[model samples]
Target: MPELKLAIDAMGGDNGPSVVIEALINSLKQDTTTQFVVVGDEAILSSLFSQFELSDHPQVTLVHAEQVVEMTDKPGATMRQKPQSSMRVALDMHAHGEVDGVVSGGNTGALMAQAYFILKPIPGVLRPALMAALPNMTGGRSYLLDLGANPSCDSETLFQFGVMGSVAARVLESDKNVSVALLNMGEEELKGNDEVRNAAQLLGQSEHVNYIGFIEGNHLFSGRADVIVCDGFVGNIALKSCEGLATLIIDELKASLTSHWLYSWFFKFLQKRTKKSWQRLKPDHYNGASLIGLRGVVVKSHGSANATAFESAISHAIKEASHRLPEKIQDRVESVLLEQH
Candidate 1:
């Protein structure tokens, strides 16, 4: 396989370069073929290098960046003012073809802003959507899109999300016949608002996507749809809610299991089973959200992600880069739009 070069914004996450470096160390253990350009403060990254004993690693290169984009900064204004920030520099490397992809555990809004400004949208795409691979029932995964990237979307934008999402599902799941659905209150044809209903009509008419009408919130993890399309506002709430609920359930189960002694062996077995199940539902396992419809690959990791979660985000970027996902999405979008015209 060809080696992939990725740029990392090491200073963006909550734990700063430490978590990024730790994740890099773990990632390198699994795949030594991948090279990384670590962008952050040279002094801090150097300290981490010594701490992690990767001072002479051939696959890692340090690029000094003077500024860091804070999580609280305004996306549009910050991207304009902080051109040389770690996050922006990493994205610049990918935009300039120095790296195959860029990964950053940074402010989602800033990341999206910078990506759109630098890479631009793929041909014929109106806007890029943030997409994440969520674990679904039947032990499969579903692709959910526009996770807080564009909070308000029109009918045409929603239709475009369906197109982009279908292409994404095909690439990620390796299933040409991917099922696409609009997230709404009910499955009735006239249930949702005008935007959703209009988008659903377009999706149903298009041969490019396997439109499955409407899917309720409960159906998100049911494996009934391979791709779920919605505006960023709804998608963000749904995703965060799922993450919170999953964490709460796991914690409650652990507490209950430890509080009992009569069923100690049974509790142990249940604990193990619950742990496995929770692992499947964990947010960290699905850490990367792709900013699809761009000319280059840019993956957004959760700002508070730990080493394991950060590594998962890196892996997601690698997969998207390896497959030339943006180009595929562009092609699909163009095809769908041409049919509409």
Candidate 2:
């Protein structure tokens, strides 16, 4: 097996290196073969090391990064002005072939902007979009594209999302017929305005995409569609709304059930048995979203991701990198573009 080196941004998330370090430890504890290059200020990492005990395993390395880019800073400005920032440092490692993959729990916009500019996309891909897996009860999970990449996309972009998403679906589940659908207000042809109509036509005629026709908001979680395509504006709303509803449900159950004496006692018992399972189901645990179409794997995690989330993100990146998803995506996109030509 070729040695895989991962560059992680230690100071990108809300909890800074604390959670990121915790996550790295979690992953490293499980497997010693995986090596990590954590990029951040040397002093802060040194201080935190004394607090948390890293195993005697010597696979982890720390790369000194003097600058830190906040989530609020402009991507272009930060890249040009603060070249040595944590985000830039990690990306530079990948650009210069020092690392095979990069992962960050940081500003989504800046991550996307910096990656697109620095790493660039595969040969045939026009744009890079975000791909996330939504938990589904019936099957393993469903993929939704353009999660937060472009607020507004054209018909061509929508078609591209379908192709990308379908490719992901195939990679995730072999022999499973991947169904693609355009997210819209209604299933009818005349439902949405011009954008929906044009996108629908493009998807409907796509040879690369499964192109199952239009799907409404309600069908997203119904497990009817394996790959859902939409603009980032709509996709972001759907993703956030899904997370919000899941959180609300969990909160309401805890609040209402714990109030009663009998229920409270049972809840305590249940918590002891099911706490780990419940925590695993939380949306934050799966923080990373692969910025699809890049020549290399670039995973973006939530800004507020915790240690467990960061670990999961890193593991996910390793899985994707090992699979060489970028190369697979290149083949699929190039084939589709050739047929178009």
Candidate 3:
């Protein structure tokens, strides 16, 4: 627990600064060694601080931002019109080495755009990809990348994602025997369109990656691979679809258990056990997607994430920053590219 510093975009997210402020309290409790610079409007943050009774938290500081990027804001427009935005300011802080990492539950497009412009990509990385750990059947997790960073990536870009993701899995998962797989329509060599097949070929030829062939979306949690690669277009849809389905199932189970005539001690007991079991796989509650392959660490939390979940995003930033992930990815990518040449 070294004295780590991170910047927070306090005014992002659908829940706005209130959730970020509460999350800061929770995060501070979880990691005493981390210092936070919460960026947003000064007066509003001050009011929230007073309300939370965290106005005197020595580890937390406030930085004022003049503009707030809305969920509806276009990335290009936001960049030009909202130069002083909380998202931009937080990234600026990270770029300038004022903070080791940044956490934001902001406009995904805007945040990604700002992050790419401010932090830039590692030298050999074609483009920065977003990666998050998803629960797998073996009770372990796999890292999925290109979570909407580049919705339409080329063969080479997809290939680079595989290399980047493989390095990331090894570093973040702390597992040297990590496996990489391309998400496809089928697990055959001839499956998928040109880019996917080409990327698979690239990964297969690379000694740097442990190419495990293709993995269909259904086997995402089967522990077939430790690192799953896909273009952002497919990855985003798959991730959200899975999340939506999980939420639906959990809600339905709760409703049925509470409303049924068999709602007795037995039913209550089942619900309790089920909830505990499902808590570990709850994607919405504590998921944080990191924008990887960038020069600095930037974690993107769901815009609707609660205090606990956002707190997890803060921890995610700390972990990646502490690991010097960007540098590691750079080294891996450089080696992989040189081998190709």
Candidate 4:
């Protein structure tokens, strides 16, 4: 296998370059075949390298970027004003083929805008969708797409999401027989608005996709479908709701367990089991979300991610780059579009 080189937006996250550098060092320890091009303030990054005694490391390189895109910056304005920002520089490297992929814990809107402008969408793809992996009830995972990318989408766009998501599931899950479904209010064919109903018809007609029809929100984690398709509006809400619910459950459990010692031994046992279960479902473990439909690979890390979370994001990018996920998605999209015509 060839060495996988990734461009990192070192100053994009809340913790700044320190977290990015630490994550890179940790990732390098586990994967020697990977190389990094850290984009940020050269002086600061260099000082950190010296402090970590990694100044002589063969696999890491530093690239200087003049500006940093803040999380609150407007996407369009940032793109125009901060062309030399670390986020833009990392993306530019991917566009120029200097890196296999780009990983960033930056403003989602700005990153998505820069990616679309620089890399552009794959041929026949109308728009790129943000795809994330969610742990399912079956101890496996499912791919959900269009998560806050485009708040609104047409029937054709939803169909395209299904194709891209199915390809993603195949690569990430290593399962060719992936079943797909559209997120709707009800499971009936006629439940959702015209957009979803139309998309369902298209998916059902797709010979290449195993379209399983409509799935309600309650079935998202049931593992009933490998791919769940929705517009960004609904997908984003669903994603955030799940995160909020998880936090509430964990906090409540902790309070309840420590409140009384009447069942101390049993509470301790339950706590241990609960902790293990929560670890498996931690957002940090699945921190990277792919901007699918782009010409090259791009993974978005959570803006507030820590070292462990950022490392997981980097690993996700490496996997997608190594697997050539964009190309796979492109092929699937073209085939599906051809069938539609």
Candidate 5:
């Protein structure tokens, strides 16, 4: 049977070992063949496992760590001071080839910093990007790249994001003729600041990218573009805005539904249908973001992820590991780099 070894940061995330433990148990239940190395305080994990009556999970292995990296602490100091941190331990396991892939709900900056420094770029990859698949009402999803990697990038960077995002879309969604668009203030050729204009020009010249011109913020869910490329600063803002808006909308709807006596009775049935329809909109539904262009697959999950979210992240990491996506991405990106030589 094909096997996948996953290193999970058990001490990370807001819920700590409870969520991580549950996620591991849940994932193992679905795929008994998969194995996990829980990198965190072994005592805490063991206690949680026993408390949850999950001692029968044979696929799990415990790896000990003495410290936990708090979300607020400086990543550099934590990396040096606490070498046994769950995040560091998990990354180290992947770096040493002890594990096929790693999943973490730890600090984003810290995880990225450690992974990039330790693993480095995949030979010729200039920069690594973060890509996420967003839910759309049109039954098709859209991909956003550089969601929080590079804060400010140039035209070449944006063009590269196009290629990277396009490749991911093809692999994840099977969209061959994927349309790439630059996130801009307007759809016109002459629009926005100099950065947008420059990126537009560069994307226009890319033969590898099916450049579909500029995309405004509102166009994110329009299903008109397959891949949207922008610097991390802009992309992060957009991602956060979407998340905040979705949360606000969901909360308001729930509040309004249960506000009255008659509505409260009907709310239960309505909620079931509403939740089913809005399942894809939840951030936790797709918690893992692929760290593209790396030599190895690194999946970043939300720091506040719960058990279900962590489970989803692990599944995602396993998929990347099974396919050797990082290797394929490296080969493709290196080929492009070599052509420039």
Candidate 6:
């Protein structure tokens, strides 16, 4: 009856089914029209559902999965070995007409591989990218793609990511003229490697994309670009480094403010003032990464996501689904590719 239905991999992440169930339980309250097909151990999920008083919730349904994909499992191995995993089951459901999208907090590699095999990439998409949203200084968000999907990419692949990412960003932002940039070593034209330089050339020649040239690491969160593109190797390292730095900054601030007994009271006061600022830096608030260019909406959550974080992942899937993101991206990518011919 509900137009939006999502398959959730309940047993995917570090904390297990409880977090996913809890997020689903809370989500049901806010959005009654959305249906949830939760995949995991039946016994464990039943208990969790009962514990959260969601046992008979009309919108929720539980589907059992025999095997659980581990964090360390190789992508290709998991695909061959575990066919009945929660992640696999969810993806299977999405690939078919059963569910509109999938949200999983499981092994990223396994999820990607399984999704590639099951859902497959949309026509004209070279490779699907792991695109994440970062809070920018301009009170908005910037999208960075190929976070860890493909470590190396050619100029054509990199150029495709820009087209796909811009379409992806349009789903969230109201603006169609989203700025695209290449994450480079420097702003200078000759600073980066061959792949990046060639990609820049392709992007600049494109009339479809609003190419903004190059963006340095320092300007990643400065709102210089709406969609930033790079190969997985550089993007993954840069993203992780930013996350690590954000954590360290928060830890240092907390330590400094509450180190002495005299400062404890003042620290508490300062914390209230800085809570909003800290939230922007924390990964918990923005835990979902869209696997763009896929035939279906598949959101990858942080492995260690809590209930709040997992809820954000679910929301990401729903938002993308509502916008018909894959179709929009396909249209844009085809338009760009056609112009080059």
Q: Mind giving the per-residue lDDT tens digits that candidate 2 earns over 117-178?
A: 88899887867899887766574567888898889988888888888778766765564679
Each candidate structure's TM-score, on Cα atoms with residue i matched to residue i, is 0.93, 0.90, 0.94, 0.95, 0.92, 0.96
Q: Mark the 10 consecutive residues where model 1 has the least summed lDDT.
A: 256-265
Of candidates 6 and 5, the better by TM-score = 6
Cα lDDT for residue 135, model 1?
89
lDDT of each: 0.89, 0.82, 0.88, 0.91, 0.81, 0.90
Q: Which one wins on TM-score?
A: 6
For residues 1-341, what per-residue lDDT tens digits would candidate 1 score against the true structure?
67899999998978778999999999999987889999999999999998888888999999999999998999999777898899989988888899999999988889999999999999899889999988888888898988988899998999999999888778777655889999999999989899998998888889888888899999989989999999999999998998798789868876776776855667887768789777887778988888999999898998899999999999988888888898888888878878978
Clashes per model (N, Cα, C within 3 A):
0, 0, 0, 0, 0, 0
| Residue-level error in angstroms, candidate 6, position 160 | 0.5
lDDT of 5 by residue, 160-214 (tens): 7887778777777744578999999888888887877887886787666788999
Give the least accurate 10-residue stretch of model 3, judged by summed lDDT.
277-286
Error of 3 at 55 (Å): 3.0
What tens digits encode model 4's per-residue C-alpha lDDT throughout 1-341?
A: 77889999999989889999889989989988888999998999999999997788899999999999999999988888998999999999899899999999999999999999999999999989999988889988888998999999999999999988888878887656899999999997779899999999989888988999999999899999999999999999999998899789868877777787865666788768789887878888889999999999899999999999999999989988999999998888878877878
Instruction: Assess candidate 3 and give its TM-score to the true structure.
Output: 0.94
Q: Evaluate model 1: give its TM-score.
A: 0.93
RMSD of each: 2.0, 2.5, 2.0, 1.8, 2.1, 1.5
Worst 10 residues of 4 by lDDT: 257-266
Residue 95 in model 5: lDDT: 86
Instruction: Give lDDT: candidate 5, residue 79.
Output: 70
Against the hidden true structure, what lDDT does model 2 obtain? 0.82
TM-score of 2: 0.90
Encode model 3's per-residue lDDT on 1-341: one tens digit a residue: 45779999998899989999888998877777788999999999999989988788889899999999999998878989999999999999899989999999999999888899999989988899988989888988888988888889988898888888887777767656899899999988999899999998888898988889999998888998999999998999998898798789868877777785676566778858888777877765447899998999999999889988898888888888888888888888889879989
